[model samples]
Target: MPQDGPQPVERELPTDEARDLLGLVRELVQREIRPVAAEEEASCTFPRETFRLLSHSGLLGLPYAEEHGGGGQPYEVYLQVLEELAAARLTVGLGTSVHSLSCHGLAHFGSKEQRTERLPDMLGGGLLGAYCLSEPASGSDAASLRTRAVRDGEDWVLTGTKAWITHGGVADFYTVLARTGEDGPRGITAFLVPADAEGLSAAPPERKMGLNGSPTAQVHFDQVRVPDARRLGEEGQGLTVALSSLDAGRLGIAACAVGLAQAALGEALVYTAQREQFGRPLADFQGLRFTLADMGTQIEAGRALYLAAARRRDAAKPFSRQAAMAKLFCTDAAMRVTTDAVQLLGGYGYTADFPVERYLREAKVLQIVEGTNQIQRMVIARHLAGPESRS
Candidate 1:
């Protein structure tokens, strides 16, 4: 049989408050998230209520400024909270990360008036958000996005479709990137668009392999008119804003990946210990024990790597290279650890009765999202070797 629940992960927190915050997160996970996770995911039910609860409890905006209705936690502390949430259910964890990503441009680059007007409501109010940069033809090549924003009097008319958006239809707001001048990245600008904009719409959510409880859809902006006041950052700095947000968002994904792998390892350890084979527990065997050790090692290494990158971010240092490395290594580690877990569970692991199978499917997507593992490698390589020559 599977264990009662995932075991607690030991953490080195910076303060007593962070430790207490982790305890509360774990409590919420056990009491609410983990119990209903499998059932809700099976039914593709979005946990809007759980998100509302997180907002009320001040979890939705942990790494932002306290004056903006955020928790004022450092990235190091904030990411561990994400890890705990992900261990219970990835939908909630990744949803929170995406919401934070959506808020990045407004919080960091918007005018003081804009932050004063919008940040508090977005951070802690009962509102959800989506980031809109990926498009049908522009996933990795985000700079090539064709979403156009034409100036119209004091308004901008946006017309494009954003593909693979996390909270596509359900978000209260979207942070959109659109081309306003030249054909390349320099001409793009960011906008904070309300979901109720006149010409905004969303297609049905995609049928995904896992994380069914988190809706992913394509959002359409059919000449939607946004006031100039809603524009974020300067008229031609969208890529800068988007890339900055992604560096932090990658750390979020890395933490979530480590949490997922840790959960899988916990399940494997419990299942193997209880399962018998030839008058001995499966865990007593050397090969399976070695596998379990490797899984645990990978999870720990991934956790440490992401924490290091997060610390760099907290100190206001250049961490783009570290962020890419963490995203690459942690997500790849998650895939390996989860797969090993499924093997350890034998035939039972393949069945829906065991969460290892769901974990395996979920791990696959992490390697693809937030810039694919390939893109991560490319980013890391650029940091090492400089940008590739165009000639």
Candidate 2:
């Protein structure tokens, strides 16, 4: 398998159109994103220009149909673009992933009028979006989210706080999953809430260990009101929409993890060639060479896992299990590869003087977000042994 800098030739690869889109994204990443990546990540600053650039390039709406002002690209192509972005900067990749997740609930389930009214702005403009599913009490158990949305005549009064909301106050809109009924997952409903809605407030950004440029916070919905038309789907379909969206979203995270791993591997390869010990290059050592080999192997495995899952999605096959497996494997690979990249760089890797440290820090969150690795394992195990296996 090819490692670092060049796209590997996989068996039965993407179509010409997909390849073209992938190439376009890579070019944008190299020219526009890579230059500012270090600085923006260091200062915990979101690159608004990057968001605008992507939106203008028709990349922001890649997975949506062409009729909705999107590029009419498949998830396979869209995910490769995400990989390219992650290789350049995790913050951008993650921000894009969150944006796509927010879009998923609406794109799949919104009424025609809702789609016609909102999708144009969402797909065409440089508007950021947030997906609110997690709460202080409900992370893995998303169905248990306490945020309440009570029907009030023609509107819904939303109250309660959502935690770990990506884009938080910065987003132009939010996809909120809240309880409209009394049961667990079955009781939930989803809504497309505007950021400017009254009583919606964001706490100061969380101080995370990595992906600092991607702001996250607790979003409090204090009796915020929205028209019933803003509902994403029927009352109980909220969990359905959220879960299906997460299935696809996991693949996006898998791609991002691969990109991050590839970046770290590239950094390590370059550093080993340049850094010498005892008048010999570090790369010349068998141990270091083996380390690089392992990193390359793990990254290749991750790439294959995600691509297979993406292909399954494109084929409209059942891919939830595959998506969860890919997310778990790739994120774990990222954590290992990035740590090894830092090890290869010696003391310099631990400092901001090199990007490997940042890569390591950025890689850690991949294991935690989208869904925790533990949750991913549960998803995979359930698929392997069937639902009765839980008994």
Best by TM-score: 1
Model 1 spans with C-alpha error above 4 angstroms: none
Q: How many clashing pairs does model 2 include?
A: 0
RMSD (Cα, Å) for all candidates, in order, is 0.8, 2.6
Clashing residue pairs in candidate 2 (N, C-alpha, C atoms within 3 angstroms):
none
Q: What number of clashing residue pairs does each candidate have, in the order they appear? A: 0, 0
TM-score of each: 0.99, 0.96
Compared with the true structure, all predictions reach lDDT values of 0.95, 0.88
Worst 10 residues of 1 by lDDT: 1-10
The digit string of per-residue lDDT tens for model 1 on 82-115 reads 9999999999999999999999999999999999
